[model samples]
Target: MSSADQSHPSGNKPLGKRARQKIERPRAILAAALDEFMLKGFWAARVEDIAAKVGITKGTVYFYFDTKEKLFAETIRSFSPNLASESEPIDKNRPVREQLTTYLAVLYEAVAINPDAKRVFHLLISEGRHFPELLDQYFAEFLAPALDRITSLITSGIERGELKSTGLASSPEVLIGPAIVANLWGIVFADRHPRDIDAILTTSLDLFFRGLLE
Candidate 1:
């Protein structure tokens, strides 16, 4: 190949292999780290094994993440749904009950039904005490944002007089508590005893709406 051809490579293609690898390596590391963490849990998981899974050395992993704790935290952050961006669309024109049901259903799908979310939740429950800072990070980045969205929905409903002044808007944790319990049930029980999750959520939502509706 001529020097010009060599320099331009695929002509319009802007990135070279080295440059592309630099962009992709961190993602690759995070994916491998998540798998390793899920398999071995935090204390038992080894950075070298994660590196081997990515076909890189331990030093290279450290070069990117600097520490296993950092890698674990980043893995959770990486897989976490950006609730701010992925939040369910709420139509103000719709009945508040319908809007809330739709919103909670979407939240349940993301937090309970998603396999990655379950694994991350298990990590938090099992290892969070050892890493309080990471737990705080998870709350700040993931849970807090989701709860804030739910609070906004409830607050709007109350202001519009569609929902009763039941104090649910101020304590959004009450809204999500069932979801957290359901997710924990899945983690602890697995398929040993399966529950009809949808039916349960529907019944629960009906009772909740009855109390909240004006």
Candidate 2:
């Protein structure tokens, strides 16, 4: 049967002929590929496997993405939020405590909602040496800018006299590094309720603030 004959599990009707034959084909392939990669890991996942999962031919998969790496890159790219780009414009006039609280809250919520993405991220960080391009794309697109934002926030806080001058400009790592590690730990190991995430974030902010406060 053609991909059009396949019924979606969502109880929705099948896509129209044009959509199924055109738009839905690539999208469905990507969705299935994401599931496969998340479950199987990037290196282990195969194009044929994704094609099989999507009920499409391997040629169809190749039509959309040239290789497994391209598919994985697209999958990771799809998961990115507008928050990263928007974060730079955050109001520096806000009180440092309030700013930190908002920052931590946003980070916590982002990770909590996308647990699979967090898992994939952890895996990539741990085993990404095998795929240097994947590592480069992941860091250049996501991690480095994120670190820059945190460093900027800390610098602003110090300028406002809200935080002690630890000379974060020269050692940006010292201010936000622990929180990055903490966030990864929370993503990988913590099983706290979603509602309780705020409390946990608040506690982390408190500890961070105590150390940084003037």
Among all candidates shown, the one with the greatest lDDT: 1
Q: Compared with the true structure, what per-residue lDDT tens digits does model 1 show for residues 1-214?
A: 5322333345675666676677779999998988899889988999999999999999999999988888998898888755665465667788867767877887776677777876787778888898898789888988887788888788788889888888777788887777777788787776797787766667777777888874
TM-score, model 1 to reference: 0.81
Poorly placed runs, candidate 2 (over 4 Å):
1-16, 88-92, 111-113, 167-200
Among these predictions, the greatest TM-score belongs to 1
> lDDT (CA) for every model shown?
0.80, 0.67
With a 3 Å backbone cut-off (N, CA, C), the pairs that clash in candidate 1 are none
Count: clashes, candidate 1: 0
- Residue runs of model 1 more than 4 Å from their true location after superposition: 1-14, 86-91
Relative to the true structure, candidate 2 reaches a TM of 0.71
lDDT of 1 at 212: 89
